[model samples]
Target: MSELLLTVKELKDIEKYSADGYVLGYEKYTFFGASRFSYDEIASISNKANVFVLLNALIHENNIEDFNSEINKLAKLDVNFIVQDTGALSLILKQISPKRVVFNPYTMICNKNDFSAYQNEGILGIGISSQLFIEETIELSKLDNALILLYGYEPIYQSNRKVLSLYQEAKKVRFPNGQLYLREDTRDVLYSIIENEYGSVIFNCKKVNLIRRIKDIKEAKYLLIDTFLSSEDEIDNVIKELNE
Candidate 1:
């Protein structure tokens, strides 16, 4: 059986959902996603519940040092670090001891070969893309320590530029992180968009719901649920519904 992991974006959420399942804190995001907690807050959480940290970011050499400093603090905690970029992975693999990390390159892993490649590189695990079909997911699950995205809105597009910043300037409006969204003008579809100092990311219009297929993907070691866009009540409901 696989374990349930909840991705928390707020401090209050940490308290709300930590009891039901393992909590994953988003430490940084250079493309999309919402808020990140302070090292102190993360340290506090680690003292209580089973926790992990997502250091998924598209980083460059210039900002890599700052990124390293932040991760170095989190690395001290007894938590897994899910790395996304090659540079970040290299930094963690080379600098961090014991190599407690998961390689999740968004939608890059298409087959078992990809998993083997990552494993060979000393990654502890890999995050399976939600875009894959259920059958494909089951096939990928055969690999040891496979991590799959079982819920949340899938990211469709991400860019290094401050897209929301430009949009806000032109529209004369303020669209803070986790508050703004993008949609097709022709129809009503909610593609959530978030902007930070790093860049902007626009998620898919429909959030991925795979609770019904849990049994099928149970072979996977971990299933991740990103709740950055979900309200407290919504997250509570999802946890109840899934646990029941």
Candidate 2:
């Protein structure tokens, strides 16, 4: 069976659901710096299963110099790093020599040419962006490179402007700790968040379910399922539905 990857925002989820006999991989949430959890707390989740640290370019863009150190710390715990920054990728390849790193598709890699560029940089895999269609996935699979098919919701809008605006507005409301409750309208939508970063973009596109599809994905050497804050049952359901 092909492996299932899940993105988590909490460490407790890892402890409770990932303790034993769970078919899931993990990617840390790195979009906002307000996770309130230290890297040590996040990396501890890796003990449950194969864990990958997702470092968003949005977060790393501000303090580019820290990328190497961040990667180094995570590497010490034997955690794989997944990145979106070209510069950071170069750094990891040069300094850390991480066991594996998947380039986040948020950078919008559309064709084989993009894959070729990263492949030259020694990147192990490329995440097919949410903007890509099935035809693009097939084309990407044809390329002589590793591929990560985005099997979950697509991260639609990422902007320092919008999130900042929301945070500012939340501060005004004094919303108990200035925590911005960013909500997306997903009503009547098979995919949610049509415009927000975590909004739904890909729909009815055959969620990487069939074993044949999984086999096609695994053929590329690495595979992952990208989902946000998914529960244990949800994770198990996706695996069962896909594997069946």
Candidate 3:
């Protein structure tokens, strides 16, 4: 059976819900995290909550020093890091045990060969890309040390450039909103978009519904529920289904 893990975008979620573990995001080191937590604020987190860091942003060359300093400090605390950049993964492994790190390159880690290559490095887990079709996911779930996305708006695109601000500058008026949506010419559904100082990320417009399918995915080591931009009502509904 897989362990149920949830993203803790707010402190309230920690008190209101239950799960095997929690993944928290801070504005400094994570992209697509709904909450803001400075380095000092989140470092003081209690060990009892089983909270960890979502350090999945692409670390740029200029910020490597700050990034390295942050991870090394975080390593001293009781936290596991879910990292995205391959460079970031190497740095994190040096500071903490490979068992405490999960390399989640989002769209990478699709096949068994790629999966095994990472596992051989002694990392705790690797994210099974949300872009993979259900059949592909079904096959990959049979493997060990897999972190599968069970629900929430999945991030399909990420960029280190300021997409929103650049567009706003071009338009001659401040867009005044970081949150926007995009739709293909032929598509009806909108893709959720959010931009921050670090970069911009585009997410699936709709939640990936797999709450009821947990039983079928018995081999996934961890099932993640990311609540990036979801509502409390939506979370409650999904929690109800998980309980059922």
Provide the overall lDDT of each model, using Cα atoms, as 2-decimal numbers: 0.75, 0.53, 0.83
Winner by TM-score between candidate 3 and candidate 1:
3
Worst 10 residues of 1 by lDDT: 18-27
The alpha-carbon root-mean-square deviation between model 3 and the true structure, to one decimal in Å, is 1.5
RMSD of each: 2.6, 5.8, 1.5
Candidate 1 lDDT, 1-244, residue by residue in tens = 7777777767666666644345464546434443566677778778676666777778887889988887787788877677778888888888884257878887888799878888787677788777888898989987888888888888877678888788779999985544677778898877877766667778887778888888888888788787868776777777887878
Q: List model 2 lDDT by residue over 119-228, tens digit each.
A: 77676666666456656665676665454543554445554444443654878753343222343376443432222232222233224433355655554544555444
Clashing pairs in 1: none
| Candidate 2, residue 50: lDDT | 68
Model 2 misplaced stretches (Cα beyond 4 Å): 1-3, 9-29, 32-37, 42-48, 59-62, 162-212, 229-233
Candidate 2 accuracy as TM-score:
0.68
Our tally of clashes for model 3 stands at 0
Angstrom error at residue 170, model 3: 0.9
State, as a TM-score between 0 and 1, how close model 3 is to the true structure. 0.94
Backbone clash count for every predicted candidate, in the order shown: 0, 3, 0
